[model samples]
Target chain A: MKQVLPKADTERAIDSVFAAARGRMPGAGLVPQIRARAFEVYERTGLPHRGMEDWKYTDLRALIGEVLPLAPRPNAEALVRAKVSAEQVSADQAVKLVLVDGVFAPELSDLGRLENEVVVRSLREVLENSATEAIAGLVLSTTNDSAISLNAAMATDGLVITVADGNAVKRPIQIVHVATGLSVSTFTRSYLQLGKGAHAAIVESFVPAEGASGYQANDAIIALVGDEASLSHIRVAADASDAVNISSAIIAVGARAKLDLFSMTCSGSISRYQGFITLAGEGTKLSANGVNLIRDKLRADTTIVVDHAGPHCTSREKFRAVVDDCGRSVFQGRIVVRPAARKTDATLTTRALLLSDQAEADNKPELKILADDVTCGHGATSGALDDTLVFYLRARGLSEKDAQMLLIKAFFGESIEEITSEKLRDFVTAQAEHWLQAGR
Target chain B: MALLEIRDLRVGVEDREVIRGLDLNVNAGEVHAIMGPNGSGKSTLSHVIAGKPGYEITGGQILFRGENLLRMEPNERAAKGVFLAFQYPIEIPGVTTMNFLRAALNAQRKARDQQEFSTPEFLKRVRDVADSLNIPQDMLKRGVNVGFSGGEKKRNEILQMALFEPSLCILDEIDSGLDIDALRIVASGINALRSPKRAMIVITHYRRLLDHIEPEIVHVMSKGRVMKSGGKELALELEACGYAQFEDAA
Candidate 1:
């Protein structure tokens, strides 16, 4: 006989919230039907738990004890606080698009000099005025995960950006999400599309206002790269000390396209960054890299899945983690080569540095190849700092702590250097250094 | 007072004693060469002085200028004028040689209550020293000892020895993997640092290196003890006759 158990408190609360908020959600025609379907999927699966293989190391059901109510619309005071917080992490020489408490704030964003090259709209406006087919296309999912389903049903507002054919956007587009409320949750979703031969750079930054704590942020981005186009996407997650963050990126690369994606996580009490990328066209190139600097009791995870459905595609994935005190880091990478993906080349490498006996690291790599002519390899390692290297530096007149710091910086250098933009690279490096200083 | 003093020194690793009842004295402005077989503890003495860990001092006392030497950390000992040129220089990736040199120099200087070097001043000093050693500017920009050849690694060690300007320098098998041309270049670099107020201890197994460095005294070691002590001519005699006589004497 099949055993049945009562619904958890958070699950029941989510059910009630969905029932009360469905009629109020902004969307006409197919949008509401899509939302209902997404909600049904969430109900069937419930919250991801330890029993699921994908969420083995990070049990979201257990970690998220209770789901807080949806955050209220930002008031004047909240906008002021968000502005101050967003300025600290805004990338230099980039157009800024600010989202305060999950709702797009046009007054705080600067889309100057980009009016002629691209088209941008808020997700709420698109849902309210755009065609049903366009609305459904914007919310398409590459993977059927429970958390993403939850996001599809609850996300209120985000950006919808598009670049025309052969248009090379000179400056980067930065989307900054600032949290200014306490004990609330925010869900935001965005979509980006590039025409043939188009080039663009996008950056996503998640931060918190001063004195704001205990917030939850669930954000998602969907990107489509056209043939012969190139795109560079960088995400920086520096949330509050007591915040819970879950972000996802669903990307597809077209024929002969190039994609460079990088992410760095230095804060947040519990955070997960997952990516689902597919090579839909032949002769595509992809590079994905990440770094995690976690301390105290904080936890960070980077999970990625790359599907090579086209022929002669090449992909590389590298990730590094530095764990200190009782912190924990998890990395899970999977590569799949379809039967048609002959002559595919893929490699994945992950390394972890444990600074104390209590620090923990978990790494898992999987490969599913249905083609005999493909080449795939993976490597994973987790250990403490090398003692020989430490002694060598100490003998050269550096204190023990300085020697370890230098080595830790070097450990993170490989992944950070892979970022194409020098400005972004230096900014990420400084963030890592700040984390090291705080740990000291 | 002697620059370095060792009185009845006995050292052990695990249960095995490597240095047993060894005594030696080094005075200012003198270069002493200690030659021995593989297991005669010549390297152990240098490591103990430079404060490498994992060695137990069963019974020993070492003094530098009338102060106990074993009571300080490796960095403190280095700041107090002790340097060791390792036989195999370690390769540290992602840290450029120039940056490492600056960090090490500034740290030692700060420990002695000296001001840190400004960027321009440090760069000028490094360029001058590196040019004399035939180290190209490109090599300094590369990772420390990373992808460096055997002779290049040895020359880098000499470059550091010149920059730190320590009072006591210990060279442990520095000539192990150098050709004649490379050996001459490294020897000249080492020769430039000799001073009336400085001392050096050169540990080797062959007499080829001694011909260029020209030590003032020679000590033959066997079975973790000094079998004989004499002038520079002792190195040649041992090279010709081999270590059998010294092993039998011990």
Candidate 2:
């Protein structure tokens, strides 16, 4: 019989977390048991490495070096300092939920200010109540992904939001994660459930507090859309240059439901965002799009998996990456059509613009089809700026830099146009423009 | 004073010399038609004047309004009133035609220290020019020259020429893919922009474009140099007598 070896470096880091979480792990009844089981799963697999097919391009073991200790629950004073101001995220009217260093900051949130018929609760508060099913549902997964397990074992607090049946929330929900000046690692998990025929839009921003450095954040969100429901999700990560951010979104779409997911990674020392989407019922539609503008020595990765399990469903995925200086960008997309899913239509396209000789881009698109009478395709391309287009713009009187900038913005215009909301589209475009300017 | 003076111009692409000892001069208000064969270096001459890359000016002097044109960048040449209507107009996706035009206009204005046009003023000007050129309203909203018909592209080039109002205009093979109707429309648009201060160079392999916008002088070119120079009737003579005789005369 083969004998198990001693613990690896990241495995020991997990052991330390497990030891530290002994009595402080928040949950009632089965919650602690679930957390322990999850930690066990992570302990067995350890941090994902280059050998894993899913993590082939982005090796966390190699990139993360050694895991920093889990962030402690913020003290009152530290919470105050870590709270992200409303003006810092957006001036648009939104239902704000604030999390400071992985702990719920009620004083910084707009709980009572919400006018819509929406239910919002803190995950920790719900974990202690008889909401055992809700807690279990939040952590339940078809696959025991190591990252999700790690988040479950260590997450201190997050939000639990629900839009009741037939409810259409007028204001978007804004969940802002703020890390204070302390260089600490944090884990957070959230759940969003929409009842039948419900509609809502949520914007999640990962922002480090002013002067914060060397922080690491692991976040996960589980969203379930019921029949005829619609959800718009936008995630933007602008962490500190020395920070590492890992985020995941697991979404399930019901019959005739719609999901629009858009993400942008404009700043981070190293960041990876994974989106797992499953069309569970017939006639559902989804559009998954993203943009990454990275510069300097930063690295960004966008990995998406779209599963079409329902008949007559459709999905479209588009991503654009712009790398400057010594930055690196990676995009991996997989679209799977199950046997029961017929007449499924899916398409994916990813393009990268490398602005410097040292910049790098890796794009991988895969499709697995088991159903007949389905249409699915994907394409990827990476190259330096188009010299002909630059010359064309220059011949019309634009400077070289200005011409390159114009082409870069134009390259991202397609993905931006997919956004349904005008204000959000403009905001994202402005964010892209800001990234471009910072690199210059 | 000459608007453009080319003295002993020699240009090469990579290793081979395309334009060998070419010389031509055009005064303000005069239109010069350069009739050439496929490899006569007419297009190379236009690109060199517009300051395109990938070309070595081995030995030449290209003077535009008394400035060394070769010393300027492409955008600088454009701001200084040199325009080239390319034989193949590049299709730029995701850049609306209106936006492209506005950016170009404003950049040129900024370089010349002129006040930029207001949005409404700019819109009105573009609409007027677009309407005059029979450009559909939808075309202005789409990407520049993306999915445009061949004739539409040629007309768009002429529309740009009208808008920039450059002092020296070089139209390189502008009539290659144009039908009779398109050729007539493009030529009329060029004729509308003709002024005493604006000189024009029409480079073509055929004489059809010269019918509508007649030139004051015509030069038969071969082997990178002008083999013969005559009046506007020179084009008709070349049409009657092919460039075979002049091909070796250079």
TM-score of each: 0.95, 0.97
Candidate 1 lDDT at A23 equals: 56
Cα displacement (Å) at residue A128, model 1: 1.7
lDDT of 1 at A204: 93
Candidate 2 residue pairs that clash: none
In model 1, which residue pairs have backbone atoms overlapping below 3 Å? Answer: none
**Top model by DockQ, which number?**
2
lDDT of 2: 0.87
Q: What is the lDDT of residue A303 in candidate 2?
A: 93
- Sorted into a CAPRI-style docking class, model 1 comes out as medium
Q: Give one digit per residue, the lDDT tens place, for model 1 in A1-440.
A: 96645668898888887776665466767887788788888887777777779899989888988887788889999999999988888788889999999999998899665657789888888887883766565663425788888888887889999999999987889999999999888989998999999999999999999867899998999999999999999999999978999999999899999999998888999999999999999999999999988888999989999999999999999899999999999999999999999999999999999999999999999999998889899999999999878887888899889889988998898788888899888878988898899889
| Poorly placed runs, candidate 2 (over 4 Å) | A1-6, A22-24, A75-86, A139-142
